[model samples]
Target: MAVRSTHSPSKIPTIYQCDSKGRENQTIAADMHGTLLIDRSLFPYFALIAFDVGGILRLLLLLLTAPLAWFLHHFVSESAGIRVLVFASFAGVKVSEIESAANAVLPKHYSEDLHPETWRVLSSCGRKCVLTESPRIMVEPFLKNYLGVDLVLGTEISSWWGVATGFMARGGVLVGEQKAMALRKAFESSLAPEIGIGDSEADFAFMNLCKEKYIVPSEQRVRPVKQVELPKPVIFHDGRLVQKPSPLIALLIIVWFPIGVLLSVSRVLIGSNSPISLFYYIIQLTGCKILVKGTPPPNAKNSRRTGVAFICSHKTVMDPLFVSAVLGRNTTCISYSVSRLTEFLSPIRNCRLTRERSKDAKIIKDILEEGWDLVMCPEGTTCREPYLLRFSSLFAELTDEIVPVAINIRTSMFHGSTARGRKWLDIFFFFMNPLPVYEITFLDKLSPDQTCSAGKSSFDVANNVQEMIGTVLKFKCTKFTRKDKYRMLAGTDGLVGGKPGAVAADKLS
Candidate 1:
């Protein structure tokens, strides 16, 4: 018999909902929020704190129960049951209230740690299942109502109508070997999992049964163990984004900030003509390597060539600086948007273009006509993924002397992405890192026929150049645009307060 909660339909928890023929239901069985989503045991910790017992009594209860809880958690194979019983004894709280509080707070707490890449994979899968040792009441609302996981299987805490009974149901602890058996029973015809991802040894019982198994490593492990090599990089550590700084590194960054600023100003003042080399020198002092591949074209040496346009793949605000330093050229960079402070402090001559296509075209054409080598990122924004955003074809129509420059940025401590509201911070973090490498390569030039022809539009030219750069850097090409990035970062549709005019004015200034 399936037990149903009296809570609203939206908050109703699904314990074991399966059709008669389980063979037809194929799901990607992921672990719960704390395991697969974030690195936090929210239910247990929050329940202890929010228990109805007085603060001192609660503290005393925890102190008294901790040893027994630890013993039960380790000694017993079905430890989750004992842990739940211990929690229920002193909790003095209704399961409904705890469930309500969990539903209210879980989203806000773990929203940032909700791995976008994981969601991207799961969402593409037709159905996904969550199997966890956490209490079903605690994790159900978030996983079902918010994350939309199709199936959830977790430890069941016995209750009397609407009250806690301080005991787990018989054979209810869904953990370890029991978890493996439950998974097997859920599916008929001896169906096997195609892929399994888990963090701890407890999951090994069922994870080992899969064709492909991935273990997320943690310091809690007894010793260093071999992990399955994944196809792509995973950017998570202990359930949080990978950006924690050690105390010594933090202090070093604080001390290095002023020195970096001084060096930057000195370069701007004394090395303006060859600022690229000076910038390269400054970055090298921070233990970064700048590798430039492929020589510039002979015509690239002629600074007076009107049609010369340096088309670069955007990775960070520092892209143009690296390109200029590598080529030893004074170039004017065109950008759609830039922080006002960054614009003021930048060493290169930068032109902020408006969204007005006609005006931007006129400005770009005039700049090219003035015999100034133009440097522009056709993608218009920085993306941290090794993927190229769709390119703008405006520059392709303006000039045919397009030199596609591939820029690859690597940092040991900080990400070099200059997303919205992080331009100055990105630069600060870029310099703070002990070693940040920037690899620049110049691809073959794009001729007029390749870029813009009667049959092929400027878009074809842009795509062709984008493909060449992606091939060289081994980056994936994505359809996401700068507008998509802005909407994501700023929460507006690439405009502030629905006013593009004000935004354009701010960017121009």
Candidate 2:
């Protein structure tokens, strides 16, 4: 007869039986899902528990050593495969999770430093490819999705049992000579790249295979080299302006409300022009360096030195103030719009006008006839990039003695454009910097005939002047208008619903 053990149903073991000696024993086994199923056997139970504990300890060790491995790979070995391995060791089921997180933010960081001109060229190229030594797992998505590259070549990382084992693919490393070999094998067809561009010496081997080679200097290893040549009338200096101010300068600006008011009152009482000079002094106190290129032309015979009709590239609100300071004369500015506080606080006279061509022309002509020197930004808005938008020619029709001026503003900490904020905020941020430099170049005097002809309208005059200024300053000429910019920033075309009729007239001309 067979011996059987009786026990409560809840106490039954999944794997337990009585041996020939009638002694109860148990064994270890696995379920269909590969989960370890153990009976009440002491030795096997302890062994399985120890194995799990060892796995946990090994995972913890990898987590602790990850940073050390990354540091060694970056500083000592400089090996791309080692870097990949370091990242791979930490990756388990989280590879997709890591990729999803990187996808959300990495494109923005990559594009911050990418030049617009570079992007234009790359997008226009029919067959574009990215060759990098970084692991394909990291770079491919960005190159393919964001940049729309046709092909990508990068280091390969291996995975095992649904987890990365910190091992590189069979090839030793994808760099230097290896990169060159890979490029040759991949592009075996007769058609090859017409031009090749690279940043470091490591890229030279493969770049040499192309018909033309251009090397982009690495920021870490190479000094920036400026290639564009500005015209004779233009002067270019690259430096930071907004910086920590000296104690004395800072104190003066802080106490400027009292001092400035006193200076204004004294100038008024004495009938002196010292107030204008003092205003300029305050601006210069901010460590701003102003460069003036051309001289003011002599007056015509009958003209009572009719104030110069200054047409400038709009950069910041301080433009009129700085130009007046540079010229050592009070200038009346014509603006489309201005804040109530700014208009009230401004020392110089500001004339506001509407977009209606006839109305604006009448106001501008009256101001000129009054012998008040007029300063205007023909672009109708401020642009921070090294580019110029289409100019409004209404000012061109008002005066023949138009002085084309190019203004370049450089700041280390803040950009002096109103695109990101309001005018007052732009000024606040600008002055907050330690130093801000302003470069104002007065180009040749532009006459109506020089810019306008029988078939050509005042718009021609505006474009001619724009070309002269852009050429001198090495700025790209663009068709973008203030309306387009406003639409981009504020999500509306203008104060009105659509583009202004004045801008439409300018475009037609």
Candidate 3:
């Protein structure tokens, strides 16, 4: 077997020469910033955390310090500039808030930026570690969960009384020689890691420490690793920013905030109050694009004596609203522990559910018997990925007239949903985009033979509806429930308000 060497009295070879084959037994240290990630810029990630965790005030604070940070980065030192950014973005923010953004938000953004050729080499190693100038808390979750990294060597953020002080600990930013030292300490000896991967001049010191090294070509014209190519699929991510906020995009958001607020409010009021026949056309004038596919079953009020149960693939708090809007009439919506403000701002009448199975069943049955069509997301919570969470059987048992609805949303600037932040803002952020789109697919309604009353089990009917919606949306159906989502994103059991009865509304199905 032959080994590739950087010190062979010849020009160092690119990562392409580092042969990923048979490297599964090797340990490697890979850089996170410019090396593994396609874009070398750090401002956007800092901005994402700042805006998501601290809101506009924190974001503004970060922006004000940008000039000084840029100066220090170019003239003084990259570490000094990064230090200022750390303080501006995270100082005084609650540790829990930062952690939530890390767990729920950063992974999707990080996964979208993987450097294809670089990832080819990094993913082959048996043991992997990441070295970067960013805070470890910010990258740890994503690196470990998505990329199979065993260790993350990065700057450490200090905390006090459960809040971040924004000051970094002892060794400061993990750049230049500092990064090399951390790698050495983690491996416990020199020459322990068999390979090193990096892209910038700042990474040279650390790359020299490994037994062998490979440089990721900065000017190489290679496409980024696509989502389908990632080591693990990013099925769940939570954040209000639909697009990654670069310097220019961040500025636009700051300027667009007030204008978007007014537009969103006006759109909501008009969409809710407009006549059913004109709801689709009227909402588009306010920057909303709605595309309805497949024929929706006629309104139960006119076509049948009993109301219909419309089950949906949850995308946002606005799912029920659009279902009924697309139908041009109000559909009764039931939510579990939905915020009062969301219900108040919404035009669709909402029914709250008590987890007591019998009580919930009665409420649903009574509503259907009244000949009022009802819409609910069987998955319970909004999922951003192209996968459906387990459908709740409760909705299946309540009615024989079951209809499955598939809903998908597209936003250019911000997501309208969150697991750890303000829940009421889901709808507001949704409408804040310049051209938000809603694609609603109404699948064929189930026949009486498929209903729970016809000897089919409740779970069977629930799953049947789930498969139908997933098929049209090109999504995979899963057995994971809303509890699985909350446990990962919010560190809860899909409950809110600290009460057992406060589980998220998806349980209302």
Candidate 4:
């Protein structure tokens, strides 16, 4: 594969290849100005915050403070012509309420998604604030405590004698141009040269107000903003989606299928102890493969005793079965579906064939209590890139340790994941032709830590795990931002289709 560099005057490089650190620099350069662009001193001191209040309960209280402040300012400022004092008192009270809410929402895992650089910049800056539409009540705690921001200017809601009153400024809306204006007004006299970071185009409106406008790159590509054309989104292809398979690959899958069956038979007939042998067998049979990159956790030597969630990269449908063979009876796999055609009750009967509204919590709870090593693909489904999907937070509750696993299926046999519009017949035809060896790569395991509060939302835990995994994997497999999906459909023009060397480079990178 040839690497394309240096765009000529006639043609622009449609895409850019950069890792996380490079992406960060790109965002800052595109949005910021002044000598501080290259200044290392400000890098650590740039505080970052978001728009949300974090959770349901706190969001409610934050919503309440809007009207509460509005009423006070409405009366006091009108009566005394000293509105700053009224707003200041209201801001303080609202800030305290936010602190209380943060305490209530205590024990959240640190997330790289939802404003990670913001936190990094804030922690580095030593001072930060949350600029959200959430009332000052919700924004204050995070701004003052977690982010350590000096100020929070947000909407206010009202409460009457502890119960919220339904009155607020313009009925409590602080979004769009208003949010941008509010932020600009607060920082008007600052000489420190502040840098602002945001995730969306909406954020660009406000971000432009700052000395710099830092736009977070989506999973696939950066997009064209109002005036600035951001970098193209990054496309992460799963190893399983290759187009043609080599001859040796065909032989491997054929040999592995029966071996898996034999292991399953022996486990039942001869009382053999190892179930993972069968799992390996099944994966090989399913036309997929596993590449164990690191040492299996000593604690996970027997998954039955440990609450292990085999958090594998999602690609093909064969993943759950492949992992099941490896784990054997020591674990139970949870999937979105199962075959109605197959009978014979195994411990695998616990599988849910569909995602229903009510069953999720119950299923996750039972699996944890049984001390079973639950196998889950955080992506929930296969996409063009396995790395971009948001991981499920269920692992945070089930186990403290997450075994980071990566799988690369040679897609040469298949057109691509239906996620990219390849049909079932297309996949089957590819299998009928030549096949490629499936490569499963397992990375390091994260030791379980109870750093996040148990009471926090599962999504929060998943977000934390995604970040941790992203840093370790370094291939950007964490959150699938909206931009990521859009880029996959767009495809890379002039790029070779299914070139082995080119695909391999993508995997390693």
Q: In TM-score terms, which candidate is top?
A: 3
- lDDT against the true structure, each candidate: 0.59, 0.52, 0.83, 0.41
Model 4, clash count? 49
lDDT of 3 by residue, 1-509 (tens): 11223353235578888888998989898898878998888988899999998787777788778889999999999999999999999889999889889888899899988998888888898989899999998998899877889989999988999899989988888888898788878876434788888887777777777888888877656678988787667767887887787777888888898899998888888876777568778988887999889888887888898999989999889888888888888889998879888887777789999988899999999999999999988788888888888888998877889878889988888888887778888888888888999999888889889898889999888888888888899888876677768776754434446555222223212
Model 2, range 174-202, lDDT digits (tens) per residue?
66656666666767764545444454455
> What's the best-to-worst order under lDDT?
3, 1, 2, 4
Question: Which 10 successive residues of model 3 have the least lDDT summed?
Answer: 500-509
Stretches of candidate 1 exceeding 4 Å from the true structure: 2-22, 26-30, 33-127, 131-148, 151-274, 298-304, 418-421, 453-455, 486-509
Which model, 1 or 4, shows the larger lDDT? 1
Task: Give lDDT tens digits, candidate 4, residues 1-509.
Answer: 11112222223111121122322222121111111112111111111011112222222333334344446545643212112222322332333333332332210111111233333343344334445444455334433433335666566656555533333445244544555666656655653224555444444445555453444444433222211111122243322223211223333433443454454344332212325546566434544445545554543444455566667766655455445554444466677643342212233434663455447757766666666667777666665433546665656655555676665455443333443222332233223324335455555665334224446456666665555555554446444433334333233211335441222212211
TM-score of each: 0.56, 0.49, 0.91, 0.38
Clashes, model 3: 5
Q: What is the lDDT of residue 52 in candidate 3?
A: 90
Comparing 2 and 3 by TM-score, which wins? 3
RMSD of 1: 12.8
